[model samples]
Target: MLLVTGITGHSGRYFLQELIKNKYEGPIRCTVRETSNTFLLDNSGLKIEKVFGDLNDQDFIDRVMDGVEVVIHIYNIHHSPNIVQTAIEKKVKRVILVHTTGIYSQFKYASKGYKLIEERISQFKNDTKCPTSITILRPSMIYGDLCDSNMSKFIKMVDKLRIMPVISRGNSLIQPVNARDLGKAFFTVLMSPEKTVGNAYDLTGEMPIKLIDVFKLISKELNKKTFFISVPLSLGVLMARVLKILTLGKINYIEKVQRMAENRNYSHDNATYDFNYEPMSFEKGIIIEVQEYLKKKEGSKSK
Candidate 1:
């Protein structure tokens, strides 16, 4: 039996689908918070058990880990560390912890909540008493049909405004990994215990592209004309403050955009060499995302 946390999230949902597609015979279980909407996984043809529980509650963690052998910890909230500790206590030896690249770079400008979560993850790794063999998987800007990530937001902004707001020079490079590829990599790590235990890998797509090029690709895919508006760093900060004042600022997204504009590149060399992880090209991922977006748009128009 395998327990998957964050089952409603982008990577988690795709991971579940991919496991089913590959004909995985193991029983799967997932945890959802009180308010989580998990109806989408109900008829997925896999033996799935959805348990309502809070990650912070030790008893809830124990209940969720009962009869579970391996656990994929993907929830990025305040109680993540507690949940991981509980998984270890339950004798769930193999655990995969999915983190984000934001932990490395975006923390500089992230809200206190984000900073605390990152700190907890680091502390959990440092604690030797936790007997679980953990593999930390960090990915950057994951995108797929179900994702409304930075890439998707960029596409929508381009569609609406016909212009992209470049925070600075827009020369910073980013490697956006497809959600499906990220799922595959997660499964591969979980399956190979000896090779992945206690190792951390940074995952990304096949190519590292500049921010401008990324927007250009989306524009091309959507057949939309794009104009680049270069906003100075100081002005970008000021605009962020203004948005926050207006109750319109998404701290995570704003911080990530600022970081990318300033250049934050994660090396995937370890991931590629260790697990033979090869992600699809950025262009291919964008094409698939565009097609899915178009389908959704058309469906909504018909309604």
Candidate 2:
């Protein structure tokens, strides 16, 4: 038996889809809130038991952990310590935590929390007090389908603009891994826990692209003749600070402006060496995502 969480999220949905596509013949269980949309998981290969509740409830977690051998945590990284504790108490064999490489961002509280979770999970041990087998995957900025608030959101924002806003030369690099590729990697780890446990890997895209090139790709995909509107990072940050003051903190643009100047580039070669992780190029991935987004838009309009 296997238990998973965050089945509605971008990466979670892909992981589930990949598992089903590969014919995972096991009783799969997942957690979801009452308001979670399961439409993405309508087409499933395994029988899934949807456990309804929040992660903070220990009783609910204990109940969900019944007979579960493996736990794949795709949800909140903050609750990782608790989940790891519960899984340990339940005598679960292994836990695979889906974390993010955004820990590199020093200003992000969420990223700090993720780093804390990693530390806590690393300290876990069984009744024997030996180190527990845990596999943590820190994925780069994930983008795929409409649910992604990263590059997919970038595409939407770019489509809505005649001139794209950029920081400096917009040369700050980014390597965005598709949610679908993360799915395959998760499956590989689950299938070979012995080889994967007690390790952490950075899951990234196949190529590192400049932020400017990303905007170009979006323009090309959307068939828009958008041009760049360059802004110095310092000035953008200052404007954001002023906006924050004027809006009484209702708006804080400094973060977004500063983020544009960051280099999010990374390598997934370790993942490839570890699990044969192979992802399509950014061009192919972005095109596929745009096509899917358009298809969904067309479907919605037909209704």
Candidate 3:
């Protein structure tokens, strides 16, 4: 039996689709919150046993971990150490941890959080040293349809506003992978544990492109050109901090702006060489995502 976490989440949704589309003939189980939306799973007609509970409950998690063959952990990296320890105790075979490429950011707070989790995951992997193999994947900004926090917001902002807020020259390069491709990469790596186990790989898009070009592409796809007003990097940071103070951290102001300032470009040769991971280009990926966004927009209007 293969168990997955966050099956209703962004990458998890894609991962489940790929699994069903490919006709995976294994007993699949997933951990879902009691309130998680299951429309994708429900509409697909795939039989998945769901363990409804929170990740904080170790006993409940242990119950779900029982008799599982491979575990695909798609959400909540903070709980990784606990999950890995539980998996070790439960004697599970293999575990795949889906992390973010934003961990590589020079921004202090975000870097610290991701680094701490990565360190703990490494510690657990070293401690296991046996039947359990933990593979870590750091994927770049994942965007598809309206489910993403990055490009989807950008698409909507561009669609609604005449002027787009851009920081600095928007020359910083960003390599964002498609949620579908990231999902496929997750599946591909999970299938080949021997080669991917105990290894950390960065899964990114086909190529890195300028942030300005990304906006331009979004404009092109939406068929609406917009003016770009460049704001100083320092000013942008100040605004984010101010908003955080105002909202009491409800905004996550730092990550939204600081990440855009740093170059998030990465090499996928490691992921590809390891598990034949091939991600689509941002151009095509964004197009598909935009179409989905349009569908959702139309859906809301109809309702």
Candidate 4:
């Protein structure tokens, strides 16, 4: 049986779609919270065993880990150390973990926890007694869906405002992987364990594009022209700090603006060579995202 986590999440839903499309014959099970909506899973028509409990609970983890040969872990990376430790303890044959590229960030504060989690995974990999094979996938900013946090906000901002404020002239290059591409990459890695196991791959977009160009692409797809207002890095950081304070620490973008000043481009050559991973270009992906955003926008108006 194959065990999956985060099966109801944004990218996880896409991965589930791939499993359904391919008609995966293996017995599958997923861990979901009691409050997690099962709309997709209920309607997916897949006979998946649903186990409800908190992953943080040791008893719950043990219950879900029962009789599982392969595990697809798409939940929060912060929970990985515990999950991997349990997987190792249970002697699961193979485990695929979905991590993020944020661990490579220059900012220590932002990447510290991710780095620590990966360090433990690396140690587990070196342990000779551990029988599980671990493969880690780090994806860049994930977009391509209305539920995504990155590009969807940009599309909405550009659609609503003619004048868009850009940080650092929006010059830094970013390669955002589409959620579908990332999800498919998970499926690809799962099927080819020999090539993917014990290997860490960076899955990114077809090419990196300037941040301003991303905005321009969204504007083009929306059939609108936007005026860019460049905010200096220093001033942007200051404003983020002020906003955080004003929001009583509810809204924080200090690190976000700081990271925006640096380039976030990485090579996916390794993933491509390993699993034939091919991601769509940002332009093409943005066109679809913009259309989805418009449809959702119209949907709200109709309601």
Highest lDDT among the candidates is held by which one?
4
List the lowest-lDDT window of 10 residues for candidate 3.
122-131
Judged by whole-model lDDT over C-alpha atoms, candidate 4 comes out at: 0.90
Local distance difference test values of all predictions, in order: 0.78, 0.84, 0.86, 0.90
Q: Model 3: which residue pairs collide? A: none
lDDT of 1 at 67: 79
lDDT of 1 by residue, 1-303 (tens): 899899788887777777777777778898887787777678777788888887767788888888788888877745667767777778777778887776666446544665677577667667888667767788887876637567788778877886577877678888888888988888888778888888989888887889888888888988988889888877887767777767755442456446757554678989888888989998898889888888889899999
Give the candidate number with the greatest TM-score.
Answer: 4
Clashes of 3: 0
lDDT of 1 at 106: 42
Writing each residue's lDDT as its tens digit, candidate 4 over 1-303 gives 899999999889889888888878888899999899888787777778888888889888888898889998999998888888888888899888999999999998789999999999999999998899999989899998888999998888999999988888999999999999987998889888888988999989999999999999999999997999999999999999999999999999889889987899999999999889999989889989999988988899999
> Any residue pairs clashing in model 4, and if so which?
none
Candidate 3 lDDT tens digits, 141-245: 888778888899889888998888898879899999988898898888877777887899998999999999999998888889799999888999999999989
Better of 3 and 4 by TM-score: 4
lDDT (0-100) at residue 238 of candidate 1? 72
Cα displacement (angstroms), candidate 1, residue 148, comes to: 2.4
**Candidate 4 residue 226 C-alpha distance from true site, Å:** 0.9
After superposition on all CA atoms, what RMSD does each candidate show versus the true structure?
A: 2.9, 2.2, 2.1, 1.4
